[model samples]
Target: MLYVMILAIIVLVYVLTRLYFLKREIKRTTRQLNELNKNATAKKIDISYFDRDFEKLAKEINNQIDLTKKAKAEKRSTENELKQAISYISHDIRTPMTTILGYIQFLESDEITPEMRKEYISIVKNGARRLKILLEDFFELSIIEQADYPMKIEMIKLNQLILEVLLGFYEEFNKRNLEPTIKIPDNDIVLRADHSAVKRVIENLVVNAIRYSSGTVTIQLEEFNTSVQLTISNSVDQLSEQDLNHMFDRFYKADQTRTGKGTGLGLPIAKSLMGKMNGRLTAEQMENQLFMKCEWGN
Candidate 1:
């Protein structure tokens, strides 16, 4: 009986040890599974952060593209506005000009009084001339805005050409009771350019000087190695800075309401012609006078 009891106790001890080892293994496996879950969650968070950064970069790129598009749209809008304004002015001026011409032609008949005939004839001639100038300006402006206008260039004497233009205006200058003073080099100054276009530009400048000068108009010709400059200056009362800024803009009249007769296109046309010829036209105010300067290059 004693041997049987001892054997039973040993068996009990072995069973208890086996149960403790089984419980320890179960706890270790649970801890390993929890660590694996934590590692997987950390990797997911890193992927989420990368996704947010990528979205932010994409948004920035889209914003830049939108800004560029807006700028281009604004530029096109401004160009369209300029074209519309020119069209409106051209259409509005023609009707009045035609009526003035018709009346002048009617006054030439025998029904007009003899004493008033000369004065009527002068008025008609001036009106017709002014209308012609306006039409010419409209045509030239159209050509300048075109992309396919031809530029016929040649080598010509700039100095002699200027002198010829000034001589043509001699009678007008005398009639205005204004003295003409010129400063030119003794030798001929040659330039590679479109001669006809340059002649028109110089003529416009000189005529503008005559129209605006109170007493005297001065012209100077200066030659450089690669370019030539012609300056025409006329004395006038002080002009506002606003006039100086927009002197070459089309249909911009400084004294539009005043009695002085001008279509306000002479300087603008001259400036456009110069641009077509790859030259430049600019204006300056000095000593209470206005100066128009033209520069041509080889």
Candidate 2:
């Protein structure tokens, strides 16, 4: 009878101890839950409970909360980008449209001379061209940003494409009074890319060079271990580091203070298209030259 009483007392103490711990964990979890509900930006769930099950529950809750925060951050970033896109579109189109309208009004004046009328007509035509370029760039960028956009990737002759793009700009280069030196390897440097996209990227780079070149332009191609590099460089007297950094930014104008002749979307479109083709476009402004580089895997 004495031994039976001793064992019964030990069993009762163990049961009470378990009950006390369980109750304490429940109370602590309830308080944490209340605190979590009250704090909008609390990033963690603080649990002091010494139970495995409760710890597991808290960890799962924290995991879910972290996922939610990540999703919210992504949504915010996307929203900001869309807002910037809209603002850029509005400003770019508006300025050119206003110019066209003003020129039209000038042409319609009652006592305009033939010379003045011809000049106004030419101005209107130029404005229309600018508007068209801006709209086309905006369209291409939108297509690139779509989540399900597909690229028809294939092997392309990188050197041949660069030569072709440069030759196509011969007339424009002549008009700008700029002579570009082209250097490509005798052997074909082939790369895996979308042919049309690659052509467009090179064309954009050449056009940018022509637009900003002060004296001469240089186009060079070289091969690396796993990729090929194409660089188009031009002399520029007054380009800052900030300008070089934001060169590929959407609708970033180096001369934002003045109404310049670039759509400001060329480099950005080129960069985005390169990314789609598993490549990259970058720019660097050295002492008196701006180098535009395109790198793609072989």
Candidate 3:
């Protein structure tokens, strides 16, 4: 009977020792968790627990901490982007508005001749048209971002479609003194995409080329093993790598000074539309030349 009682005491002591360690580990982990939650300066959760279960719980809590930090970073990035977009929009609107106002004031001048009056009126009209186009692009971007916006994707012969878009821009090209060298496959290059979306992408690229090109514009279509790349190459007097990098960013202008008249939303919208179509739009700069490439996956 004495031996049995001693055995019982030993068992109880072992269990109580384990319980004591378990409670200590739990307390330490709780303290670490509370510290992490309260202090933004706490970069990581630090705890040493002998219990495997407590260690696992610490790891899970750390994962949550990491997720929270990442979410906060993303929120800050979005806020900065929103601020930049607002600044760009205001600058863009103000430029054309200032021009319109100046032209109107000139029209009221007493010494203005008939030819001068006609020129002032024409300038005002152009400024109004530019403002209208910018507003429309903003609206179109919103539509594209809508989750439930219906898209009609079908098998489109991209080569033929590109030709049609180029033809439509013939007058604009002539006005810009740019006769693009176009190379396309005689064979039908068919892909599944939205017709209107593809057309808009091509048109935006062509317009961008016309606006920024210095010497010649060469547009080419080539098929790779898994995708087709449409490249628009143009010569520029000067362009930086930074410009190439942010060219597709919303409201990012190569000429940040706002000397160039562009809404700066064209490339961003085109990029977003391409993403919706499971494609990509990228840019590169080579020896005073800029190339905008649109890739469509097969």
Estimate every model's Cα lDDT from 0 to 1: 0.75, 0.84, 0.87
| Candidate 1 lDDT (Cα, 0 to 1) | 0.75
Candidate 1 vs candidate 2, TM-score winner: 2
The best candidate by lDDT is 3
Q: Could you give candidate 3's per-residue lDDT for residues 1-298 as a string of tens digits?
A: 9999999999999999989888887787777677777784576666654567767877888898889989999999989988998888788888899999999999989999999999999999999998898889888887887887677899999999999999998898898888899999899899899999999999899889988889799999999899999998889987887888789878788878764767888998899889899899999888888989999999
Sorted by lDDT (best first), the order is 3, 2, 1
Candidate 3: stretches off by over 4 Å: 1-11, 106-112
Runs in model 2 deviating more than 4 A are 1-39, 50-67, 214-216, 238-241, 285-289
Comparing 2 and 3 by TM-score, which wins? 3
TM-score sort, best first: 3, 2, 1
Q: Per-residue alpha-carbon lDDT of model 2 for 12-111, expressed as tens digits? A: 9989997888888778767766776787447477666466887888789889878877998999987986787678778878888999999898887889
Among all candidates shown, the one with the greatest TM-score: 3
Q: Would you list the clashing residue pairs of candidate 3?
A: none
Residue range with the least summed lDDT across 10 consecutive positions in model 2 = 40-49
Which one wins by lDDT: 2 or 3?
A: 3
